[model samples]
Target: MNNNLGLHETLELHELLLFKNTCLTKANTLSEVAQDQELKNILKADAKASQSEIQDIQKFLS
Candidate 1:
């Protein structure tokens, strides 16, 4: 990935990566507290997807 990102672009990607990490954490925490089976399942799926997105963003930043 020859992403010769400028300072602004790098900062934006870092922010996005941080947001994804936050989302993953929130989903995991909410899933633990959620009583409904359906909601828990949804949160688990969201956490998994967030992890994937975070990895993708990291690749670009790297």
Candidate 2:
């Protein structure tokens, strides 16, 4: 996809991507030592979704 993003838009996209990356990392870290099975499951699911989101955003940015 052609980026065609203006400076402001590009910066906003970069910020959003960074935020998503941070959330994904947090989800992964939490899931690792999560004790409650249910909570762990939820975290894992969220992490999976976050990963997908990151991939999508990266695809768009690139």
Candidate 3:
């Protein structure tokens, strides 16, 4: 990859990591007060997706 592209990828990966952390935090918070099962499920799915993205970005950065 070009140097500029690599830099962009790195920044993107960092952003992904931050986003994933935010999702995980929201999921945990919702779990504590969640009354709707469907909502909980959706939040869980989002957290899982974010986690998967983080893993993919980490692998790409390596």
Candidate 4:
């Protein structure tokens, strides 16, 4: 089955991957300095979402 995306879609996906990576990095940094459980949980959730987005981007690139 053909799975190639248009150029615009590919670029958009690339941007999303970059954004997700950035968010994951920020989340990790925040997690280390997080004093409250709620803050930590929020960062953890953001990191997870970023990871999921990265996976989706990978699939699209493939």
lDDT, residue 49, candidate 4: 87
Could you tell which candidate, 1 or 3, scores higher by lDDT?
1
Give lDDT tens digits, candidate 4, residues 9-60. 8888888889889999999999989999999999999898889889877887
TM-score of each: 0.93, 0.88, 0.70, 0.85
The TM-score, computed over Cα atoms with residue i paired to residue i, of candidate 1 is: 0.93
Question: Which pairs clash in the backbone of model 3?
Answer: none
- The better-scoring model by lDDT among 2 and 3 is 2
Error of 3 at 62 (Å): 2.0
> What digit string (tens of lDDT, one per residue) describes model 2 on residues 1-62?
63587888777878988998999899989989989999999999998998998888787678
Q: List the residue pairs that clash in candidate 4.
A: none
Q: Write the per-residue lDDT of candidate 3 for residues 1-62, one digit (tens) a residue.
A: 23445776778778877877888788878866889999888887877887777777677666
Residue-level lDDT tens digits of model 1 in 2-61 = 368888889898899889999999999999999999999999999999999998888887
Best of the two (1, 4) by lDDT: 1
RMSD in order of candidates: 1.2, 1.2, 2.7, 1.8
Q: 6, model 4: CA deviation in Å?
A: 1.2
lDDT, residue 61, model 1 = 74
Clashes of each: 0, 0, 0, 0
